[model samples]
Target: MGAAIDPQVLAARVRNALPAKFASEKRMFGGITFMVNGNMLCCVSKRGLMACVGAAAEPEALARPFASPCFGSGRRMAGFVTVAPPGVADADGLNYWLALARTYVEATPRNASGQKRWRRKSAATEPSRAAA
Candidate 1:
């Protein structure tokens, strides 16, 4: 069997494939998130890539290979669908999913908590300026 993919590498590949106008951030979902205009486009998890393609397109997205609920079990993610492993093997497929995700996130409401939850606070440092 082929070597298992490292989620971090998968996430980086997806992020690098996105257009320059877009920006990406690593989040706590155990994945890397790509954003366009401050909206999350896609996320790459340990399993595969999750594309955000509105509820209307959910059924269709799910039909694709390796597609599944963003969260393994439990509540379903309304607009998110996972991309098959083979699909994410190259930039063409990666871009395809990223475009779909961008469309969905752009239309959806911003998750204020999402960003806040993932923000990493700087570690406390020893006194840089000694008190007199």
Candidate 2:
């Protein structure tokens, strides 16, 4: 529980700021993560704007007002930062963070898909539980 904006509102803003092409979204880490070409660009959640600004840019991003290190599972997440609600209260503020995420994501290698590459076993592939 932090100074977070409504996830829906933030999600709408993200949709407006980023292009649909090469962008996809998924529910992860208790919120929705926007992925670009398979890499996480940013996320909107109750915790705030979780941005994947890359490790090199992490320091500068954290230096900005209302920005703090992003944490997951009680540990600091490298190359990510959480911008508090005040930091993204206005459209301009939100856009700024989105731009940073876009720049970083663009430079990364593209995956086969814009979504996670996790492989799930289908019913046919799954071991027969009854036999076990």
Candidate 3:
């Protein structure tokens, strides 16, 4: 059997690196995922870090050491890369990936469902000042 994933360790790092609010956690993909602005930022899986970079960043991310395409079923998962311990051996390395995921999550456009992933809750949920 493989090693178990430590969610507390991963979650603590994310809570420290990211803003206190606007981020939520959920259990999915057999791991604990950190979601930013309603979009998936990353996940701590039994394998390692599963980063949700935009499709445009996929090729470059794959070229990096210890990074490989995340797989599911019989297909390669697009826009997601798994980085093992060798890739994020230190805080700096983990921070680098966190930054990458943040940048992509912020820049990505709203998808077909009309859900705005990157918009802050304050802007989307609260009534506008003009309306008030």
Best by TM-score: 2
In candidate 3, which residue pairs clash? none
Query: Per-residue lDDT for 63 in model 3?
Result: 91
In order, the Cα lDDT scores of the candidates are 0.69, 0.88, 0.79
For model 3, the run of ten residues with the poorest summed lDDT:
108-117
Worst 10 residues of 2 by lDDT: 110-119
Model 3, total clashes = 0
Q: Per-residue CA lDDT of candidate 1, range 14-127, in tens?
A: 656766656747574667767665666777666677777888888877787656756546777787787767777878777777777776777777666346656554546544
Off by over 4 Å in 3: 1-5, 110-132
Q: What lDDT, from 0 to 1, does candidate 3 have? A: 0.79
**C-alpha RMSD for every candidate:** 8.4, 4.3, 10.5
Q: Candidates' TM-scores? A: 0.68, 0.82, 0.74
Question: TM-score: which is higher, 2 or 3?
Answer: 2
Best by lDDT: 2
The better candidate by lDDT, 1 or 2, is 2
How far residue 10's Cα lies from its native spot in candidate 1, in Å, is 1.9
